[model samples]
Target: MSRLFLALFLFLLIREKYGYTNITLTVNYEKILAEVRKEFLSVSLDTHLIQLNWGGLNFENQRVQRYARNLAPAILRVGGTSADSLYFKPAFGKELASKNILPCYDPCNCDMDYKTVETFNMTARQWHQLANFAQRVGWTLLFDLNVLDRHNGSWTGKNAELLFDYASRKSVGPVYWQLGNEPNILPHFYNRSINPSTLGRDFLKLSTIVKKYKAFQQSLIVGPDVTHPKQDMNSSKPMKYLRAFLQAGGEALDAVSWHHYYFDGRQATADDFVNITHFDSFKEQAKLVCSETRRILGQKKSVWLTETSDGYGGGVRNLSQTFIANFLWLDKLGVSAQQGIELIVRQSFYHGCYGLLNPNLEPTPVYWLSVLHKRLVGTQVFNVSHNSGSKIRFYSHCGNRKSSLVVFGMNLNNFSVGVNFGKELAKVKFRVFIWTEDLVIKGFKDIQNKFVKDISFEMPPKSIAFVKFRKLVGVQACK
Candidate 1:
């Protein structure tokens, strides 16, 4: 049988396999809460990966290209902690070294003794390969520039200018730029700190450099990509740092960016993935970031969650790679869109345990969810409210199709919760997507897809579902 037929067969096979209940909830789609960019869903490539020879990406592999294309028109961000130390070489040869800095072989092994600067190098050939791969896959490139390459506590921009000149000469045009990665925590990693004022100055200098190159003239400059904005002992308060950065370099920036992670991989548990409180924490952080951006930079600049994932420290092995992690991943997309974030870049698209695809290019559950989201969810966000309590999250967005809306959510409760989309959607057809508990092992074989005519249905506990309301009469926002 064909693949489509097989998918359809499996979808039908599990239609009535799970039980149902009468937990009716409501959806309010009259207002558009926020709108996101057409290219809202994006992925990030860790610099360590490129330093580690593509980190097993194998862009030459058809499967790799195919999987990547599934989420096309995305922003492929080449950044991470290693971005601060990576430099572009003019040619392919022995890697350059400076400040007694050794070329980074292992991206994860960080030296706690930060008396001297550590560095990594990539050749011009590798740079072109990266651009070629992104072009082939129809992704926009967002390159993060090195911030630690400074002289007299000021950004030199010499290395960045060389890279720009190379990209321009090589005909790689129109890549987005970020000056640094988490400058608030710089003191911890490099035993150095670029105060927000200095960071702002650095960004301004980077902007001037960007404008000099014809190829990078129109590129969007986004930064100061800091961590979550909260008071913490380990790093500068991101909120205060962000405010200072914007005050100093707001004129140079086109957008605001930040990173977020729900749990520390070293200390996270499987149960944390499904915790409603953790999801709420992300919602709160997103709100604060959005509000801060608007307060400082005004309403014109967009906010981006440039780097985010479930577990920050290389991700928790089995938990991050398994089916349970979708709870946090799916909710993040929902909350970010609702809170007016224009783009979200998932970190290490193919590097660590949190990768959407493993090194061999085999997809994790979240990869499939991302595919579904890109294919089904549209840029128009609708204001959706429900009385389903904390365990159930409901978000509505204009469907990819005209006059259609897709309402998606995950049931955190161990028992099924019935949902009612209200009388407004009483006659619409529902397409339910719920996978079996063995999703990580069986892949799509465990996915259940069926069209239901009923206005209400029960979603199995700990399961995520996407219901597309087709044949809708009126949803002004969708149109």
Candidate 2:
């Protein structure tokens, strides 16, 4: 079947089999004197802030900058597929000889060296420029190192130390240092010969070299930032590498970072745009990995969803570029909230599939949603529940400036529900946020970009919604 068919089939199967709710309701104040507590985690953008370790040309975008500034407490994951290009591959043929000296290392063909002082000078200048950029934005930096540098153990501790010192000296300290960008899976895609155990050893070596620099003391070392595991460890998977890291007593690193993408690579759904379970699944996986890593490390180090997106590659060509991104990108924030995770950054704010803005920097529908979550949600509170597995998840939040209710309405059974808050919820006012999908057939983008007019709605089957709340002007009895 086509990817689209698979998506539809998956949604149907989920609704028919694993869906949790059968009812949903809309409510007004004075009906439920429910006490909601403020429970928002810190917000940050996973800045792509793409870098060039090669000829030292950085493609910095002002739109991305504006996005980051608008979303403060941003985290910039500074590597991508381009991360592999330590230097541009040069051509020896007479046809096109203007090849830049490529950065050759193990498992990669980065064998060329600098032929001119200009290239070396350019690299140094770029690092400084990137450092300045991070400090200006107050970015929580995540430096994904070039692991291929040590491919055949070519990049010894001495060699790795040079790069680390260069970064520490030129750039502001990296808040988190991921060993490599999903190395476990790179072997299959890049034709790399490295295995999980080798990946682990290299990580250790990289960590050691990075620590030699004095500045690394202030920065945290996080590692194995493995790509999403295949269902059955089909390729150079991370599970074994991680298992080996623990067996080796991985005390050199401080945290474990991992990536996740929820949708089937082959498909997209009309309601797929509206699914929040993807966020839940990604967060859950990160949570599980974090739990397992902590168990292995025998310490309470944090786990970071350092890199994640909706589609596998550049993402499916669909409404993901539109409003569905709110649900798609909400994983960055909602997952953090769900797991009490310390930090989670989107894979790339502007890469092909995961980017929040277009090449022109037009905000995707998800960007606005991210803004709402960052600005509107609270920072600390207890668990918010509204009956187990009901289509609507109600959260009551109270804080210095506001008290609110957030209802996550999910519909799958083609059913409606009348929900009454318990006596504990009567005093709150309702100000809902809507998240229903544009009703479409399973395969079409029929209503992908559209949503309900308001939070008040009869949630359609196979749809999702988020309704928020606030107390009325004169309800001070709780004081």
Candidate 3:
């Protein structure tokens, strides 16, 4: 009896050990979790650029246009904390002039010297340049209006009407609109506090203004952009604010939007980027937002991660700008899709530490990942289940090719993990791409031209992998 017991214990231990090393992934192709927007992954530009007069952007630069084109079929969001203070000089009334302005020396001398930090000005010329640039880049423009402009504690929206009137006259085309930027955190940054109910009424007024313009008739309105739910005195708790906003004027919004960052940029460590617990936190936050939105507004209105990154304060210095950041970015895309987020606008295209490209317009690891995602993955997502638990994070999607499917995931383990596809993907030919921890890409070759009975591969530790089955047998969903 003792010998038999010892043998059973050894067998069980061996099974457990091998099971963890070899992850088995199965996808339910028929069960589509969600269909992401065609412009699912978008990018944003901080209005701070215009407020600070940081040379704005050399929209004429070939390199800049080239990189921007790569992220085409996206929404170019013009918003940030500075957006709340932005004033359209074309429509600046005498009443707005009474507010104290934060002055600065303009480096470009774009005639922006007269503005203050509390009241930065955007000229008509700058507006046309930005609108033209968005048109030229084949991107949809989502502009955020100044919500802090008030008269007797009510949003006047006179400036927003003037800006929209100018755009309509110029035929600037359709523009998605938002009322503010991170309204929950306004008290901390701007010493201004507007409750959610008041903000909702403000949104209703803004919606009325937007409808007045012929050019914006078909445009979408999204808002009450807030950060993750946090119980801090500096900001309104995001969930509470959102509920109040929706309750007051939920019908005014076309979509619900929010922002997220896994860690604070100033205090992030390299290890924090790859922490599994941190990823779980992100998932939980997303789930909470989705559930709350559905409960309040129902499924009619979609949710958006309009502004997000690795860390909030301009991103982490070395960690966010490195290849390690792909773990979070990739995981974010996968999780966002699963949670029914229609759109995720990455913070910036070219301005900060979190920018996909450096000042020189060179690609980062996340940029390449975006490229691969755009070229290979489709809108329809398949439900993927893996036996290796959280050690291997996996997502499956219908590929861009005819009768094809793609399985992409990250291996968070410090040691390489092996992947074994289910029988449904057996006898399939695939090409693989693996981005390693050292920022080098490996494994781009096709396994074989002929069908393989069983497909298996090693995922390098702390790396991302994409396996595309050129012709996934018996998968009718891709059709």
Candidate-wise lDDT, in order: 0.80, 0.50, 0.78
Better of 1 and 3 by lDDT: 1
Worst 10 residues of 3 by lDDT: 442-451
TM-score of each: 0.89, 0.68, 0.87
User: In candidate 3, which residue pairs clash?
Assistant: 102-116, 102-117
lDDT of 3 at 44: 92
- lDDT for model 3 comes to 0.78
Estimate, for each residue in 380-406, the C-alpha lDDT of model 1 and write its tens digit.
Answer: 897776764788787889999988889
Instruction: Estimate the lDDT of model 2.
Output: 0.50
Q: How far is 116's C-alpha from truth in model 3 (Å)?
A: 9.0
CA deviation > 4 Å runs, candidate 2: 1-63, 87-122, 151-160, 170-175, 231-233, 264-266, 271-284, 378-381, 388-420, 435-479
Highest lDDT: give the candidate number: 1
TM-score of 3: 0.87
Q: TM-score for candidate 2, please give it.
A: 0.68
The sequence of per-residue lDDT tens digits that candidate 2 reaches over residues 103-144 is 221111222222231211124444555566666665666655
